[model samples]
Target chain A: MRKGIPNDPGRRDRLRAVALEFIAERGLRRFTVRGVAERAGVSPGSITYYFTDTDELIMSAFELLTEHAEPNFNVRLRAAGTRDEAIEVLIDYVIDPDDASQQEVRAVRELYSLGSRDPKAAALVRDRLEANARTALMLHFTEPCAHALDALIEGLWTQRSWNDEPLDPGMVRTAIHGLVTAFDSLEGTSA
Target chain B: MRKGIPNDPGRRDRLRAVALEFIAERGLRRFTVRGVAERAGVSPGSITYYFTDTDELIMSAFELLTEHAEPNFNVRLRAAGTRDEAIEVLIDYVIDPDDASQQEVRAVRELYSLGSRDPKAAALVRDRLEANARTALMLHFTEPCAHALDALIEGLWTQRSWNDEPLDPGMVRTAIHGLVTAFDSLEGTSA
Candidate 1:
């Protein structure tokens, strides 16, 4: 079992933060206790003291990544009064270059890469995505539509990252409007 | 410039195949000349002879991954007679477990992880995605809709992968239907 510190939650948090930075800057395969320790200005023993297993540390870092993202999404989403506004908010979140920093993008890619091979990690990613869909449901989207919207949002975010040139905002908005219109049409249907 | 093995194209192809398998099984971060050497049953020096730089070897492996995926997609896509059928083909490509082997999924995830850091790699991934969109255009989808559909297909495929439980085929089909119907509505629009 991994041991937990009775105090110094801040230190544990710092270690996890540094670990995520390590993952963001370097690939996950290169992660090591010593690497994180050096960055955190702590000894290797100090890191092991909080989390006995490296997997546990890595997972903790992933959780931190999620925790950082959710609140920001929630704040903007909760502020929207109507479904259309919410949809626009989601689009803005995806297409706005400032919304997800490069560090966050890198961390997400690393975690998703880990998820590709590890079911437990996959579940963590799924939970976040499903949570986004669930929020969409609250905004009047049907279940399937909500899920599709969630997928579209993530896909757009990823696609934007890959393009060397900037995405034309007008085209992106139009494309998403088309999708959301489709989902709206299905609102009264069985789907 | 990287040296070309003009005399033994077969040997060069074998090296790329082995490198891709190594990437699929392990990961890019863990890829090393010695590691690929043992797996390929060749000496590390011989591996370097083919790929003077490790980055060159990794990129070639990625190209091989794309080559394997594109033909399967192209054949099915070309066979679709209408836009609706093309969409179905795409959805099947995503939902069908048999379509993409687990190895392919792992390798793609690893490459996308690399793309998160490397602009050149990002371009490669973007090229494959844009190619899919272009095929959608040939099937009569509008430019914006084609790009949107491409993003949706990729998003759904990724979403399905994250789910540990089997996705209900009916729900998956319905979700895609809703999105496509919207794209179709915009068929003649300037978008």
Candidate 2:
């Protein structure tokens, strides 16, 4: 372990963070171990010694991203005791992401674009989707409604990411509220 | 003027179509006039005659994409006589896109990703967003509801594009209904 270049745990973590940032800055297809090594000011060999392959490297970066997000999700979601609060949680965590960076959302979207072609990347996206749906269900949303919320979060995120301006919270609240009401009506009819 | 290798209007249209397909297949960062020429079986000089610069080529491709989409939107939207019919049109045209191919969606997303850094691209995206919202409003959705519908369409498109399986139409209907209901209640409250 030579300062920031070798197989230290901290160095390994730093490489993963750098890899994700690189993908976020430049699109996923531009991601290369050598590129990440250059950005991190370490030799390619030093980085490869820790990651071995680019796929492993990208996967690790994704793991780190989820690991960082998981706790934030848990804390906020755990605090929500009502449907209204649950909507706030979904908006903050997913659509608007007041606590998350645009880079993080971009990185995840690049991974999602990859999912259209790569099976492993697809599995990760599916896992995230399932987890989101499960989160909504835990908040007492019906199955279809939970998926709807998840989809809305994803759709809004895309819209928000592309535009330079922040979405009005008032509008986001109304949209989410609309979805909930629509589903509530459906549930009422089916029941 | 020589078959498919000159400044002919037919060849120009073909080049634009090829450029969009190339971006959809290989992503926007990898797009090159030469690459599109190769894909179109034309020479780079021939392409330059129609589009002197890559920016023009890309913008032209974006224009062609909209030209193709606009008629579909107009025809379908014009036929929708009721709220439920409007929902069905939206689902078919935006969410599930029964008539549109996945390639079209991917190409649009590539342009949207480009919007984050490029001002021209950003304008195009904003235009598309505005147009979608306008369509929703014309369906008698209130202002906030129209925006919400646009966001849901965008969000659902993102979800549907990334996944291999088609989203269940029944589930999609429920989600859209939910948002509309929520907004309807708000409108009623205000009235």
Candidate 3:
């Protein structure tokens, strides 16, 4: 077997990173393969060589953002001493104004807009979101509570997207506490 | 005061309805003031005479759609046999495929995408959403529970926008049930 090109993986990752930044800055409506290539100091053909089209580049960039965030989020959740701490970590990550990943929030919103018309994009987003929800649920709660918790977390994220005011951390914590208690009581009954 | 212009109000309503249909079919990306005027069977100058710009047209169409849906929703909710019945009515309205007003759902999602970059659109969506939330809370639950329920309902609508599989009516009922029960429990504790 021929050895893989030594720097090929690095180049591919660099291209995706640049594309993500472009998506964040200009939005998917304005994102172009040539733009990404130019910003990455690469040829336009290289983008085409790596990604089938702009849609693929965008979908890949979205997948990469989630993949990057997942491990860190899981670690934070696992390390939290209390449910309140876990909820706080989630809210802080979600609503932080300084984070570059916040741009992904807007990007995902744009993707959803496109997805309404494009079935392929819709499928890509739906599949990834369901997978993310399932993974998050499995990580955080038992089977009985996982579905409801997923719904609650998803609701929180959606609210953050639309609400102009910064979320009150205390209110979020109170909701989380209520959810946890509700789930615990639910578990006792089902058991 | 000048006597009301006969047919003037009817002409404006017809123009707004046509604008809604055109925008829904072609999307805001391809929408043009001239195109809307042509479809509405009015002169381009007439369109401009009524609305200053494309943004004004879009904002007006959105307002028209919201106003049309609001009263019907309120009437249905008020007529429900019980609180549970009201929740069911709300859920059915939100997820109903047969409802023509569902186009409003699509329009709202588009407005959200626009809101990310356009402060005016963002403010419009936020103000309307918050006002609706406040009104619903005042009618359905105590202040705190209303706030929480508003977030939940808004989150559910956003999720519905991207979901590929048709929402199960039963699942929707479960979510509403959980939220209502949680609020009722909270209210009891406070009492």
Candidate 4:
């Protein structure tokens, strides 16, 4: 079992915040305990004391981001009156992303890649993506429809990060709406 | 500007092959020139001597993978004269992945993450995805339709990596056909 830090929430939060910063600025490739320590204004030993395992620390930091993101999203999703409303809610989230800084988007992408190599991290990523997939599956679309929607959501985010111009929100909505309409007509319950 | 490695293709290929192995086995997180030297059975100096920059080496290895993958993919893609046939070709590549080893999938994902933080690497990744998206766009679909299709293709691949079962080719085909059919109906030249 891993030991806890000095029982200071502030201190613990600081360490996590610093870790996220490292992940954001340098990416997973350069994220290091010493880097977190130096940025946190604490000793490297302090970070190790709080989190015995690096993966645990990484996961903890990620959960913090998720914890911050999911509530409002879930609330909005629940409040959505219709299937179309629910998808619009989802689209808004994707277009804006969870972190206003857009830090999580990059960090999450890094984690997703990290998951490929790190079984534990991969599991965490899978859990989040699967949760999203489940939500989509529950919609009127079939399994493949859900999968395609999920992929389009992720793919657009990725495309935005690379494209010279920032993605036009109207175009994104049009594209997303087109996908939903198309899928609805194909496998929708009413049709 | 990066200096060229030695004029020997064999040495350069060995370095890249070793780098690919490290990327495949450990991923880019632990990928280091020193590590490459140890795995390649060469001194650290030799690694530095051949590749002036680490990023250059990484990019070279990536380009090598691309060169190996794209030609075969393009040939198959060209052979598919019909729009439906082209999507099938796309599906096969994503489903089976380029390398049966599945190493390329993970490696490419890592490069994608790397791209978000590293401008040069991001450019390389963008170029490849853009090229792919362009090919899709040139088909029967409009720009947004093509983007959605491109996104869905990538999204399905990602979802599969996390899903417990192997991606069903039948399910994939069904989902793809649905999306295409939906789009075709929406923007049919006749309609």
Candidate 5:
């Protein structure tokens, strides 16, 4: 068991924020409870008190980062009234290096890596993806189509991680447009 | 240093074969070199002699599994009667479970996890992907399209990893078809 901090809500947020920054900078493999605590100007006990384990801390930190980014997505989606506009926003988000924080990208990569080997971690990612898709305005397609869209988006991110070349916004738009058109055409047909 | 097992090229093959089986049966996180050696009926020294480290062993074993399942993609491309046939083969190969071993999938998941945090490991995967694309029929596309296809494939694989449903052959085929059609259209426009 670890000792508790003063239990300020701000303190917990600050700690998690610092942790997220560290994860993005150092990569998740190198993140440690002690290191996060030190950076946050808190005791190690405070970290353990807020999060029971390393995985818990990592997961929470990830959740925080993603949740923070989610609003931006929502703002974009809401601003786009048509399907094409929505896709354009999505493609822009995906390929625009300036739109994404390096830390956030690194954190997502870490989550993906952890998810591959751990069922619980994988479930976390799956749940988030499903939840995001459900909330997404792009859920106008059938169940299979929606799921396939998810696959395409996830696949795009995986590919993005490996390459150093700047992703072309136009190519992304074309790919998403192609996918949407294909699914729309296949609506009545058995998938 | 680890001792070599003499008089048998089969020994190395057997060890890798068994290693793949073990990985499929048990996730890579739980797999060990000793366990692979034992399953192969070889000594630990033999496993070490062939693979200096677990990462090397895992990577090589995966490379072997991929080669074993699919015809040399590059060779197929060169011998292809038409560009369509080559693209079809590539599509068929990606989604065809018959040609892809469970071990190969596991190895990929493992590599993805490592690549998330390790730049060097990520570079290897990126290089492999670029090499595969270079050797394929996509050289005709503008450099951006060629790279976009790589991202699309990577995203597809990553999505497949997190998906809860069993692999759908038809869906895979549809995705490949869609991708090819989109690329073909790009060619038409460019021409």
Candidate 6:
């Protein structure tokens, strides 16, 4: 195992980390093995050996990004003692990510646009969405509610990323609270 | 006015129209002045003559694309006689964009990602969002609902673009209805 190159866990992680950093600093149009290798203190040959090509490298970095995000979500969910608290957690997760994580949103979006054109990357993003929906399902959401909330979350970030309007404070919480309470009443009637 | 080269109205419109077509077929990375000019049967200098550079051309293409979408939204809004019909219109607008417009979605997304990096492009998108929100306000939605719906629309597209799970037929309608009904009840209580 040549450290930070091949057959080493640390090398793989480092490569992924640096790849994301480069994407964050620059857009995906310029993501290059040589650029990452130069920044990461690894040889370009090593990055190729491990990643094969730019698509592989982009996918792997994205995988690392999603993996990094899963724990925060788990923590947010665990912190919710009630359904409303859980809704708050979900909204914040979508719109109010920490500074470092905020950067990831832009990076991931670039990857997503890439995915729309590239099936391999699309598969990676799609797998994550499925797993996330399943996780929401496990948390007692009805199927439609699960999909709606997921899409709503996606929409909030999508708006924030490209929109000019400053999202009002408490807006999401109001919308989400309204959504869950409606469903709660529906559950009441059905039950 | 040198027909296809500057000081001419037709030249600008033609350039914007062709730029969008190329973005849909090839995405933004390969969207170039040369390519667009070649496709339009004009010299590259003509493109530069009409638009200052690539960023200006891209931002202009985005402007033309959004302008094209606004009328459909207005028509959809006008067609809906009831709140439910309006909600349905909103859902369809987000998810079931038609063939030419489907390309616009991809094209807009690329422009959006481009906005995050380029201030000039970002300014263009932001201006459109402000105008859109203003129009929604004139339609009489409360502030929260308007932003939430916008975000939901954005989220639906985001999920469709990246999520692995296929969206259910009525999933968006259900979610939008749920949120709207919740707020309606809230309004009922307050009134």
Please identify model 5 stretches exceeding 4 Å from their true place. Answer: A1-6, A69-71, A137-148, A188-191, B1-80, B87-91, B98-102, B113-119, B137-149, B167-171
Worst 10 residues of 6 chain A by lDDT: A129-138
Query: Which numbered prediction scores highest in TM-score against the true structure?
Result: 1
Q: Is candidate 2 or candidate 3 better by DockQ?
A: 2
lDDT of each: 0.74, 0.73, 0.65, 0.70, 0.65, 0.72
Candidate 4's error at A55, in angstroms?
3.4
Candidate 4 chain A, poorest ten consecutive residues by summed lDDT: A132-141
What tens digits encode model 1's per-residue C-alpha lDDT throughout A111-171? 8888876777787787874575567455656666667766776777777778756666765
Q: lDDT tens digits, residues B152-186, model 1?
A: 76677777777756556665666566556655655
Superposed model 4: Cα runs more than 4 Å off: A1-6, A69-74, A96-101, A136-144, A168-175, A178-191, B1-6, B70-72, B97-101, B136-140, B189-191
Clashes of each: 0, 8, 0, 1, 3, 2
DockQ of predictions, in order shown: 0.53, 0.49, 0.32, 0.55, 0.35, 0.57
* Order of candidate numbers by lDDT, starting with the best: 1, 2, 6, 4, 3, 5
- lDDT score, candidate 4, position A81: 78
Candidate 2: interface RMSD equals 2.3
- Each model's TM-score, in the order given? 0.87, 0.84, 0.76, 0.85, 0.73, 0.85
Residue A16 in model 2: lDDT: 93
lDDT of 5 by residue, A1-191 (tens): 13443667777788888888887776654679999988988889877878889878887887776677555556777778777677777777677655355456666666665666678767767777445654674545555455555666665666667777766676776667666666666775644
Candidate 6: segments with Cα more than 4 A from true spot: A1-6, A78-82, A162-166, A185-191, B1-6, B78-84, B162-166, B186-191
Candidate 2: list runs displaced more than 4 Å: A1-7, A29-32, A52-56, A69-71, A91-99, A129-133, B1-6, B53-56, B94-96, B129-133, B136-139
DockQ-derived CAPRI band for the predicted complex in model 2: medium
Scoring only the A-chain of each prediction against the true A-chain gives TM-scores of: 0.88, 0.83, 0.75, 0.78, 0.80, 0.82
Record all residue pairs in model 1 with backbone atoms less than 3 Å apart, i.e. clashing: none
Q: Write the number of the candidate with greater TM-score, choosing between 3 and 6.
A: 6
Ranking by TM-score: 1, 6, 4, 2, 3, 5
